[model samples]
Target chain A: MSAANPGATSPQTVHVPLGDRSYDISIGNGNLAEVGRWVTSLRKVTHVVLISDGNVAKYYQQPVEDAIAAEGIRVTSLGVPAGEQSKSVPTAQSLWEAALADRVDRKSTVVALGGGVVGDLAGFVAATMTRGLDFFQIPTSLLAQVDSSVGGKVGINLPSAKNIVGAFWQPKGVLIDTAVLKTLPRREYLSGLAEVIKYGVILDADFFAYLEANVQPMLNRDPAVLQKIIARSCELKAQVVAEDETETTGLRAILNYGHTFCHALETVSGYGEYLHGEAVSVGMLCASRLGEKLGVFDAESTQRQAKLLSALELPVATPKLSETAILSAMQRDKKVEHGKLRFIVPHAIGKVVLTPDVPSEMALAAWREGIEDESA
Target chain B: MSAANPGATSPQTVHVPLGDRSYDISIGNGNLAEVGRWVTSLRKVTHVVLISDGNVAKYYQQPVEDAIAAEGIRVTSLGVPAGEQSKSVPTAQSLWEAALADRVDRKSTVVALGGGVVGDLAGFVAATMTRGLDFFQIPTSLLAQVDSSVGGKVGINLPSAKNIVGAFWQPKGVLIDTAVLKTLPRREYLSGLAEVIKYGVILDADFFAYLEANVQPMLNRDPAVLQKIIARSCELKAQVVAEDETETTGLRAILNYGHTFCHALETVSGYGEYLHGEAVSVGMLCASRLGEKLGVFDAESTQRQAKLLSALELPVATPKLSETAILSAMQRDKKVEHGKLRFIVPHAIGKVVLTPDVPSEMALAAWREGIEDESA
Candidate 1:
């Protein structure tokens, strides 16, 4: 087992500055033990509806319940089957009823203790149950640790679309224990790196260079490297989120840089075919290539990301799906305003813009070019 | 059919002071005719997903749709069955699917044009769909016009609990037309007056006294009297809502003066046995009696409310049900914390406070007192 170095294991807190909704994201290696103290520090919680999933419960639910129970705070722990399917309406309904049955009230706090699916589902329940409850997140997966946990995006999917029904309900605090990542399977672990890379490419040039330099350490799961990447990604994402929490301003859309292509790819290829971050990996490259075609971004930067993604073992090639299907999927996104293509094409490694009205043909051409690059 | 007198017919706007969530309640005899203009005046809306129920649609959907369409705003009208049963998960799921099918998007405004049921069900949909869409309300029922339209409490019931699953989603604007109340059944209209009277007793002594003076005119549906009651009721309710929007500060609980008894009555007696306002009427009398039993309130004030409620055609008599059943039902209310009864009791007209831990026996005694008044 790769232990995060003592220095890296030291707790780091990232404060999401959302005014009244602002909360700290405590990131560390072994701070899971401090959860009870950590939560009570935020608010006077007497009852907790702790939600988790089957896979996560095997490793963590006990320590969590014990830690919270130790605080003299009553804990009602409920677990659902693990995986993407749990992010559905039925799952949400069951959780709502379960929490209510166990005596959840306006004063009760909901603590989400699992991956992105659990965070999203649990957060949605907290948002609507009793018209919002104080929510705390103990995100367990690498994908959640750096991305979903940082943002307040939580919801369930409809059969027709993923994340079709949801609310941007922020958590009171998020606790990310890096030690848990040691238990994450290889594919899921690497998929998370794609999003970690996303922050650097979209916002910070220095972070991108750091990730570029730390390939070997990152590959070996060096605790120091993992801590640095996770903390830096959260900080960058927090800055963007604080600036545009509700996405009312177009400023928040920069975070969706490649999401258009990513969503299209995920939809056209079917959801399970690509874990979200994996599609994001392939999607980012497509967005980068589209930038190159637009003449604002260079091929060197595109190649740089390609090399990094491939080194990280995330797929870089566009799948062999019909271009028409992909295009229709993009237009179908409720996020897309007026059926027009607004691509978040990166201008350089660190900058991107929400470019509007790039013809459907141009987007298609960008996809077609990626299909030709065998190594990409 | 009673039309609002021309003078009372002039639009009276009540502004709910909730910072950015603040919106005006525009009440007039015929403001429904200008719903499109009223909506556009509040926000830049291009598309409207107008939600109405079967009963409301029979009277007002087309005019509302045409008014919006005439303003060059696209309208997608949807109709649900008109009743309390429609405020359920299955109904919400169906509405979500139907709205998405009609191209509901982030920019699409959701306009709820019905009673409390449609307002809440459609509002909950707008609150969660795409993480919330701009919502407007055109409440068509007397019960909705003065009460539900002002506060942002929107949700659905779990068969186990009323409003157990919901969100505090505020509308961008709410338009209420008193003219529509002319079509409201006599029973429903009288039921709505219960809430109108509640505000006077809970917040404003002046309004309460005014209501006393205008009883005959109010019963006659004098348009001038109608305008005074509806406008004052909204303003008072808005003041309480703005002071404690999400009910976190305990100030909002004052609005629930009789809700504990009313909810338990509705739950135990089976919903629809009494319209919400009718139950509220009986519940208020019960609470006043509880107040009198506790020595803080005078019997004269209790008798005054009883007289007004009876005069207004609302039931003041407690239902013939088992005392234990009512006690258990109140304990089961999600609003009741830790099984102790927290009653919102009046010390006098125009002032109420949330009193905690009034013994279950005392509450039952209060209920028993109401049963003894033969004329109540």
Candidate 2:
């Protein structure tokens, strides 16, 4: 980790060391404007396939494209409809064809300029086009900047599954501009904070406390606080990814602390009903309660998380969805092995364990207990 | 390289040493029956997604599926039409969906069980399904056994491009049964020999001489010679791939000795106009002639290749397609850099160099000289 300046607003670099696939994530207040210099500084680029979503393209695509083009690089700006629906095979194919139509060659680089959907889809295109092209990331959304953009995991979703068809295609560089969060819708911004809190709970207790203390600044979109949390989240993730780049060792499973429950909630509730991190907020509480049920975690820790999540304005209570459906979706999750359930259950803040073969009833109870009461 | 038995009839294994990504190619007569044992010996398996083309499924798919199923492993056999046309986005998507419908999971392995088209399409399916499944190759065609199956380059084609979308996804193991070639149509079988001959031209002079001496046995598809040539070809290709796994280093370009011209001919003449290797047979001569034009190669070497290719009964004359279309196609080749024509030019039998800055006129002249004389 290195900061270009000592001040909180200055650009910071978090190096993700994965041998030959290792790269740096540059975090700053308004580094989006430095997109041109950032890309050229990493590698020579004659052509770029700049991919974004409709919502993102309006605010950021033009400036990002212009920034890169200012370096005398030809940028092919492409956009898909906003939201998760665009992260499909059809969209991936369209992007591939569009890039090809623009004469994107092996020499051309792909730069993902939107949120996770764009990052994952565009990364898949980069990974497959001409066997692969160099890729860079300019993640616009907080969720992407802190999570998807840092990891090499990129893919399109199958209709039956989310994040199912993809590859570990690492980018040459990731440029995160925290200033962009200012334009993000208030709810979406809050949804991202849930994940920011996840890093602290999973890896660093001190960082968790920092986040808890800075809720107001985070809500204010304070550049200093944003840079710190985003940088720390990326650092925590990069450490896990560097150890297990492909998740082969299961060391990476710890990052999925609440994701097993998170995915189930999102699926059973129907996607788009719960934005990912919002569901993650609800899911974390469920997992925490499950941990308490399993006797490995305490109620106080769960309450602590619930308090912080409520304060951050993210959903702390799980919605009223079918418990059976949630359980079934959890069973169908990629995490379940040999018909047995597995979850990343927390023992304490900064310490989680991958607990396997937990009884279905107990897991279901965790979800059931979190339901909000209509009478209340 | 190691042989299970010293005799030529016994299975020989060409180990592709790519560290953790390494796997072996097993070559023998009638080894297809041993497919079950071979795959299980490599890794643990519960479910297998067997992908093949319609042309091959009629003969081998049943036995292959039965063999694997006999081992108590579930086998889901999938098929596509038997031509290059099936190597497209729609075909790939259908395979993905079909595999998912059959409950394909992260633990399931994908086995490609046909020629190059099936091998490539299935391998791409394997590469992407669940972000990559363990892949095994059962190359029925000689072209696949010797070339496509050996390298990890697997992908589908876009309507506007051939193999423009793909990944370098290696198979866990490759089972090459020389007996399978017996059912191959003659023209297609001969087309495969063109690639086998290419291995000798690019890297192994002794192998080249051996191929030249064993022309009759090769043409007859003699069991021992088939195993020897296929094993030698895999060994040669594996060596190149091991040195430059992802084409990052220039070493892998040597494997594309005739492919630049081959792709151009395939394109301008329309894709189905020439089977890939038939085009290669013509392309290699053009390259040999280009080498001669540049004064780096002797005409005697060019004649030697011509004689071997002719004796192999492969096409030796370039088709009369539009020269402009051919030139433009060549320019569009992934090999061309900065608008400069480049090619793998042979300096001698078993010795080719990736020659850059090749003048367009000279490349055209090479193609022109190979044009058949209708007057005669």
Q: Which candidate should be chosen as best, given DockQ against the real structure?
A: 2
Candidate 1, A44-153: lDDT as tens digits: 99999999999999999999999999999999998999998998888999999999888788899999999999999999999999889999999888889999877799
Clashes of each: 2, 0
Residue ranges of candidate 1 with Cα displaced over 4 Å: A1-6, A372-376, B1-6, B372-376
Model 2, span A40-139: residue lDDT tens: 9999999999999989999998899889999999999989998888889999999999999999888899999888888998999999999899999988
Model 2 - which docking category?
Answer: high
Lowest lDDT 10-residue stretch of candidate 1 chain A = A1-10
Model number 1 iRMSD: 0.6
* DockQ of structure 2: 0.83
CA lDDT, candidate 2, residue A130: 91
Residue-wise C-alpha lDDT for candidate 2, range B252-359, written one tens digit per residue? 999889888999998888767788889999999999999999999999998898999999888899878788999999998888888999999988887888889999
- Which portion of correct inter-chain contacts appears in model 1? 0.73
Task: Quote model 1's TM-score.
Answer: 0.96
Per-model TM values vs. the true structure: 0.96, 0.96
